[model samples]
Target: MFSRLFDALQGGSGVGAAVRRRQVDAEVPNFAEADDVRAAFFSSALQHAKSSYDAERDGYVWGRTLRPSYALQLHPLNTVQTYTQKKEFVWVGLTAGPWFVGVVVLQFNYFAAFSVSLYNVESEESWRATSRVPLPGPWLGGQWVPNEKGEFGPTSAGHRVEFSAPLSTHRARLCFAGRSVQVDATGVVAQQLPNGKSAGAQRYEVHAVATLPEEFLGVVFPLGPRRAALVSKVAAAPLQSPLKLRLGGTEWSGDGYLSMDYTRGLLRRETRWHWASATAPAGYGFHLSEGAYDVDNKSVENTFYAGGRAVLLETRVEFHKVTAAAKVWTLTGDGIQLRFRHADAHDAALHVGVVKTDLYHAWGTFDGSIRVEGAMYKFDRVAGVLEDHYALW
Candidate 1:
């Protein structure tokens, strides 16, 4: 049977050199101070963050599944993570079939070293913050350099700082909340600010963007024990969310201009993970990836994008979790033979960093579900629909 489905997708011999020879160093937990939770999910064009990525405590499981054409990450600590000033935002979407409202504004020209956070999930109020002090840099007292590698604000007669009004074109819309919401993109730059107060559930007045995020939200990691080093049992633990994905089949768009190698800091960028599936005749097949933790090459860059082709999977493949369940809530991985169901839900949670998780929930997939995390069950059917190649650096 195709070599027993290639020995259960290479548990056989050649699909990641014997599962990277049994990975089990498991040691990247030392988080405290309430886990230093500082969330981020500003892909703006009219808000979208109710669980762009969450870290549910209880053992461990960090999430990130943004789709503008790829950005899936699954990590389980062992030390060695790096996502150095690696910005990947480039929005301008306005779809219909999949519902993507619009409203993009760009001009965050460095205010300080860096900190407009929300590149994680599990909201906690205090949204849209930018520092470094210097104000009006695209005009009135504009200042702050570098544009291609971070640092914004700077236009001084260079003219260029327009996100227009008119209720910001229907006040843009594309929300997806998760807690003490705030959605950041930097104080509108010319107007809009002063709306924080509420805590935990308030998603309105949307419209906010500055693009550059999708390379799996740059760099994310969450393994076990509520990470950050035990997370002090994460407020009494209960976390265990690792599998469950609906995965909107395929929709496309690209506006290019993302390349680099940083001499080797590695951004040897390519940017183009376009999709086109739309399947769900009970369909289920997935092996996605994204990476940014070469921690001096300890290994794990399983970066690959199918259909649009971008295979890189083989950073020593070895992300074994095997069970991951969630009844009626609809989530079954490995044992249940991979399956996910949910396509338009909001109110998300799951933060293992700076911890602000309230369990978790995020859906927006037209079908074709299957999110595996520590899966393995073979008896009768022996799990069909197989075709694997997963690597998430």
Candidate 2:
């Protein structure tokens, strides 16, 4: 199989060659206290005051409570104890009303990618499709395991995608050929904080969410040393309910909101990133990402969702373009400021030799505003999506 995947990539030992291997003096782990990792998922109880993966009492926990098992032996690639790379992916975005949808499913065990997109805010028109397969293909199945219980379904090209949550009824489906999208939500519950105060379910206290739990930015750091660990979970919410879209063939259903991205460790072998997702319908929204699994800024997956409550932006959101044919892009930090006017885009690329991508999916309109805490949220033009990625996995 491609010479044992190029002898596990020129024999440097997995996790993308341990991200340029060079650190091993031990002593790492002890940086999770930014208010207990932002109240560690503010509690409804998926429980994790420490449950697994501990280089020593865990490193990050904004909540999903660790508990992922990795075992790839053959130590000494410079010790992180045989750090194997296990990355999983799930990205979903929908803004129902006038229609805006996106779905992504990726599994890099050998190769996998699927994408479906549509946008139409009173007739601006857009449709996109993508599919790449090559890893014991069955579409995709299992292993984002934290609190457990998840499902994925896929057969082959003429695509159909499915995601199930099993407990609080989180379902998603996207069909091909004729185009389709259906989403049913009821996952996070417990809300009431426009100062009316109700948000209770134990711990971390109030900042509500009614149709969902919109606040999941789980973290676990260390990429060049300290056991090389890296875990992630990102969420953007407003899938408040009622969303059904079928373009060109006309179907359209109401309401919108959903943005999810999840991850698993040992990455960085030429990974680039700049992501943005917007949501609205009174529940406001934002989810901005910064390059390759945190470069030095420790923890930052930048989030700010209100009305559905989930605010954590310790500053660090910057993506400007003076080149790459700038179509007008600027994302600032610290109390935030935004401006993205690209209007229609969905380009995907794959070089296939060692796996390469040029992924771009710009679909714009986000006029600016975000101040959290001191309260000041706004985004005049709204309607979002901006992902400019480059990967060599």
Candidate 3:
């Protein structure tokens, strides 16, 4: 199937074929005049066409397609420094009925990592495994944006971890300490039409393809004059196919939400951030963060997904300090207030020569509400995860 898609992208004249497009001029739009949060945020004149990659301007886009309309090439502003600072990763987090599942494949120019974690919500039984191996060369790891059909992984040989994200399905397999974890998640695409034409083509033609699952956030922020990073996030609806999570010889399955993180490009040497993701049944979810990417008039990533549609929450978030004895952490911002109760955590501290990392992925329940456009959406004790991350590479 992928072979045919690749062949079509290579020469086919269909919608899958890559088209040559120009970048949008970097002009800030009047977000105040926009109708909805999604429209206001996406109204930024700094947009990127599906087939465009601009080193001078940063932008974001989202689509209902399982993969991107065009393959993202490795284009570095500081070409000579690409080998040292470039990074790529594909992370998927799911909330099955009584389980929390995660699969991540990450590759820095220096090393690559594959991690799989599973938590039984009711039993409080948790297991996680992380494998980090030094990269022999810059091009040694797997590709995040391989072809038109799209595939991402840190498929370093002998790692015992495998993951694939294609147009139709997402599957992952991991083995550690003689125990194993597997995930199979699938979702139905919301077919959209504009003027009786395929939304993909129409969006490509107008450079408006960066829209959503109905909601998404993508941005390219400058790390330095010569360095920048592209971070795209999506908090999507529950999958059509029941989420299947297998761990310790038992299988757990149910409808759940999915959130993805796709980050690439040169980033800061030292970075820290407080991130949170939570989802309620019936397609209510949000992705919020407070560091790494600056929140200003033109750049922000905080978003709410209501009814499978993305709405912008362009306010700075404050993450309260988390201590060993901390049970509930408060997160607040304009029109947003939530509490995250700690359940269990996967913590790790890695100090390899000059590279250092202190990471914590905590899973629990989120109880609170957020006000959007004068309407309050509230949830109680919905499954969620909070992350405290500091890295130097």
The root-mean-square deviation over C-alpha atoms between each candidate and the true structure, in angstroms, is 22.8, 19.4, 13.9
Q: Write the per-residue lDDT of candidate 2 for residues 122-241, one digit (tens) a residue.
A: 665555544555552222322221111111111111323344322322233433221122332212222233343434421110011113342344444434332333333333455435
Error of 3 at 3 (Å): 17
Put down candidate 3 lDDT per residue, 1-393, tens digits, no spaces.
Answer: 475334222222112322333321222233222344244234433343342233234323321222222323323223224345566666667765776666677766466665655555677555554555564333333233342323222111112233333232333343211111223422221112223222221000000011135445655454433244556666654564567544333455677666666676556778888888876765677888887665353226688877656777878888895456666789999988899887666677889888898988787788889998798988677777888899987
Model 3 pairs in collision: 61-210, 62-210, 215-310
Judge candidate 2 against the unseen true structure and give its global Cα lDDT, from 0 to 1. 0.49
Q: Which model is ahead, 1 or 2, in terms of lDDT?
A: 2
lDDT of 1 by residue, 1-393 (tens): 454333322211111222323334243422211143212212131123222122242122232222222111112211122121112121221112122221223222211111111111111112222222222222211111222222111111111222222222112211212111111222221111235232332222322222222221122233222221100000000112211111123223322111101001112122112111111211122232222233223222233222222222333322222235321122222222223222211122323333232312222232223223433222221111111112111
Worst 10 residues of 2 by lDDT: 147-156
Full-model lDDT, candidate 1: 0.21
Error of 1 at 154 (Å): 23
Consecutive 10-residue window with the lowest summed lDDT within model 3: 201-210
Error of 1 at 293 (Å): 8.0
Could you give me the TM-score of model 1 versus the true structure? Answer: 0.21
> Which candidate model has the greater lDDT, 2 or 3?
3
